[model samples]
Target: MRPKDEGACSGDGMAGRIITVAQQKGGSGKTTLTANLAIALRRKGFTVAVLDTDPQGSLGRWFMERLQGVGEDGGLEFSTSSAWGASYEGEKLKRRFDVVLIDTPPKIESDLRPALRVADLVLVPVASSQVDLWATEGVLDLAAREKRPVMIVLNRTRPNTRLGAEVAAGAAALGVDVARAQLAHRVSYAESLGRGGAVAEGPAGPGRDEITALADEIMAQAGIEGAATIR
Candidate 1:
């Protein structure tokens, strides 16, 4: 094992709960959600770390920006744990981080398998579109094969659309848990990304509230009581 202290620290002391943010489809907001959720959880006082398993390296750059000009008590930490290197860095860091947020690439590759194999929960971001919904099946099938607790969160959803209902029904039919809160389509999320930090740290606006709500839903699902559990 890596012996911890490699990437970000998730509060609660690495209880073997690895949350993987993944989807077989691109543009599903998997990385975005992973980044923000990690920060939100850290804000809740949990020592959180992010495992940037994707090859695209978007999450890596985001972390670089977040780390710049920041003091030691930064909210979150980021690390790169590829599929082949999973047994090394990931397993080692798990011993230290309270919660590990893993960002997987799009597709069921060898790298994805190792990440999923270690995950306590899998959060899949699904856009409000028929194609994206259909694409979710592949990942869902993989999760089923692994018997992991998978939850779907609607991302960048249009206001008052039937997509939420449809996604809810689809997830229910597949026996996958769906988040109660759907993140609405907002420029703030994108804008925050452009600024290289979390929406919560950015200007106060609707996106911050949405991220907070989503984080609460995730915590509730995980049975986490308060920020104390994280710190």
Candidate 2:
């Protein structure tokens, strides 16, 4: 189904919301979150696509594994590229799809700049650790300079920990919006994605609730109105 914002034209006159998933730090579950969010949004009856601008191509590999039926129904229909020059195609995909999630490289200077320039919303996934939180500052700085609306999604957060709160506050201090719900450090999230399916498509295991909750918080922050067609 087309997104409700279909009439709104992008900078190139396309109709879609370009959400860039980025963070300067590695191993913070950037690709994992991007992949799952693609599925979550698609399951809600909105057409979704992913643009992997990372040199590592982790998101692209995940898509390949998914197509082989190694994982759950990602519900995303899209492609991956190593550079932003393909953005014309990316914009086309967005117009054809409801939402386009851009998975950017870990560095903010090179590959990420172009995508950020065209993004409607930027989702920076942060892990719960001093090193990760500290590392987030660089990316946040870049986003701030770009003047893009940045929202922090705390990934792999441990419950009842002062670190989580500290991270959230630190992000807010930077004037970045931090989603109230955070993704837990769960084996199910890893295992589900390993099997080529997002947590939403995996068995209703231990981490299912956490993934769904995270999805809900993201939708709220993105200004995605109305009830989602829960899968």
Candidate 3:
């Protein structure tokens, strides 16, 4: 853990890609995805920061917990914002890191729109259920309205089930890009977060492999060669 001042600051003087993680429904593991994804990207040696715009502030809380040296954050930068301040803060954060990931509120309303407007890519996580798959529709429409590219991430996937393959097929049929990497439902994810560390930062496991693939795929989707060359 480091001082609060060690987090991202203003005037970075370069613009990096902005990614917004959003979903219309809750229990999609949105905050969990944000926290772990930051760790995965940092593993790639990129300067990553989070612009946590969710009112629940779970991401902020996790960052605070990590600051107490409870887990392995790798000194990743994190910032928080009110409901509508995501756009402004996201822009500022991009200047300081290779990527700025925005975790939006769990709704498809006003608060989410600004973040979408500034997003280079909007990642929508869908859990393993028809209901979870249905939840992405409104969010997809919202991202379309903002002219932002959207990718569907199958989160908390039960590997043996057909639900994930089905959801990916459905989204593909509709011309939406579904990430090839599926973050499986794992006890390690919950345990690591509780310990203030990402699964990627914990010992080697299925959880770590999934997020490592996710980081690679997301960076490629953003046309990023690597975080080391962002400047």
lDDT of 1 by residue, 3-111 (tens): 2332445354545347888788899998889888877777776667788878899988877766664444543557886666654566665566656788888865555
User: How many clashes does each candidate structure show, in the order listed?
Assistant: 11, 6, 0
Model 3 TM-score, 2 decimals: 0.89
Worst 10 residues of 1 by lDDT: 1-10
Which candidate tops TM-score? 3
The lowest-lDDT stretch of 10 consecutive residues in candidate 2 is 1-10
Clashing pairs in 2: 70-195, 71-195, 71-196, 71-197, 72-196, 72-197
lDDT to native, each model: 0.73, 0.74, 0.80
RMSD each, Å:
4.0, 3.8, 4.3
Candidate 3: Cα lDDT at 107: 72
Candidate 2: residue 139 lDDT (0-100): 77
Q: Which prediction has more favorable TM-score, 2 or 3?
A: 3
Model 3 lDDT, residue 50, Cα: 89
Q: Which residue segments of model 1 deviate by more than 4 Å?
A: 1-16, 69-75, 162-165, 228-231
Q: What global local distance difference test value does model 3 have?
A: 0.80
lDDT of 3 by residue, 1-231 (tens): 111123455343546788999998999999999989988877666667888888788888888888876544433778888868888998887766777889888875787899999999999998888787787888988888998998889899877767767866776765688899999988898887876788887776778889989988898887666644111
Estimated TM-score per prediction? 0.85, 0.85, 0.89
> Regarding lDDT, does 1 or 3 come out ahead?
3
